[model samples]
Target: MAHLLEGNFGQGSGFNECLSEHVLLTRFGIGINDPKWISIRLSLFKSITLPGVVSQNTSKLGWFIFIDSSWPSEFISDILLATKDFEFIKIIKVNFYFEYYIISEKLIAKSIDFYGRCLVSKIDDDDGISLDCFDVLYDLRGDFFACVFSSGYEFLCQNRIFKPSNMPFLTMNTHFDMRSLDDLKYLRIGHHRVAEFIDKERRNLHVQDEGRFWVYSRHKYSDSRFSAVRKSIVDDKKSRVISSADYHHFSIDFSLLQEFRSQSALLNGVPNEKTWLRQADLNEEAEKIYRQLVSMKRVIDEVGADVIQ
Candidate 1:
């Protein structure tokens, strides 16, 4: 029911009301790497990343996705294929190889209108949120400069094995006002660096620890713990995959991902992420929704007057 519709992306309440409505920025980026590596992530993204977003059970708002321009033609093509129906899903590409922090900085900076009163939420392309994630974040983020939401599922991915960390999960959801982006300490750093600088700006921060608003796919490529000793400081994750057992909680599909890896040349470094990505292995029913997600042209088109209802 939440398919992307054509027209202007504005709330119909007049200019002032639209201005006052809290805008959100959801930052999702796939770090640039080799062609095959990029391909692997592309596959996972189709399954794990995009769904939890487009299906949000709330008023339509702002969402920005940053991607690498260096990714292969097929990879890019698939991105276009899947997102063709969602007009609001903006794809801002970093044209060139990699500069981790710089790329992230630009993604966040450009996606947001710093002059406006905006609340930005960062979700990795590999992770996902529940259907009502935006609604909850928007409601609870009132007057807060920063906030951290509790993660429901942390797929502890290490050495290519998975151990689900459910209860006693990680507090990984982070978001803040556009004004907070003015700080020199974190504005220019990588997306994950906000944790280091967040403490300084938490006076009006909101903390949600009761429910799992999103799924945190913990892996090497995930944008957390760059400054920590061993990426273990995030929500105090002290150890690696705690006794790998065949546990299933988050929506993950391991076989399709493995098959893609075995078929392609992407087995050197990246670990296999086994999470429910509904779009990965599409049946007739799944394929119908997959095909309905909008095109790149629709994604670029703007919502000018009426609010998304």
Candidate 2:
């Protein structure tokens, strides 16, 4: 994630410029210095995101987090302290949104030079994957291809609900396979709309409905917290109340719910217990502009597949 930076939204969509401080405050609802927003985000990062990522069965992966350099120093310190125990979890501070792509390209080039192939994956700050996601990705690595782990559970935190979601092209990470540094095209784009860039023949859509391989959570601070489209997908009648048994099944720490609840109390007394989506005219307008600003687009030129030596 670019972490509140204005990145390339689409090929023709003009959102590459760094957002003004005024726009940031309006788009995100809370300023970066807001204590309530920081508390909620940190709570989710620690309680929900880190546990499953740390539980990965394989050590053959690197998790890079791109956070804005202008974030509050105290907040950055908190993040560093939280991730201190995990060596593979790197916190990279970027001055601008587009800088991450430039730095990531160098990182990918180094990987390919050393290993002859690399797999680039992506995940959100508030989402997680199965303990074996990296293991599966490394096992299925190849040249000039893509993979999506389509089976996952979508959790609504306020309501404490878990729904079985079966969507096409759902992935935690490793959506693109890079056989050489020229494969940088695959790494430059976001995970949502691969079909627009990669042809149907080269992309592999892995659907494993029998097992849940990822966890997508929705909370008040989420970027899509006000999105009705997201609501329709995960808030179905088929969703069930989450329980202790499901916690173990999803590789989530049992204490996550309590931690989130306590954090909610700190933020706003947990008022929206029944609904995570807060409805308001201003909120709707902000959400609309936010959606328009942060869109999927190809960031680099396409590089053809590498020739076998």
Best by lDDT: 2
TM-scores of all models?
0.56, 0.69
Q: What range of 10 consecutive residues in model 2 has the weakest lDDT sum?
A: 20-29
**What is the TM-score of candidate 1?**
0.56
Q: Write the per-residue lDDT of candidate 1 for residues 229-294, one digit (tens) a residue.
A: 224434454334423222222334455444544543434443344222212333345334433543
Task: Give residue 303's error in model 2 in angstroms.
Answer: 27
- lDDT on C-alpha atoms for all candidate structures: 0.47, 0.57
lDDT of 2 by residue, 69-188 (tens): 656878778878887876565566644344455556656666666667666676666776776766666665553366667777787766677887766564363366666666687555
lDDT of 1 at 239: 35
Note each model's CA RMSD in angstroms.
Answer: 13.3, 11.3
Q: Judged by lDDT against the true structure, how good is candidate 2? A: 0.57
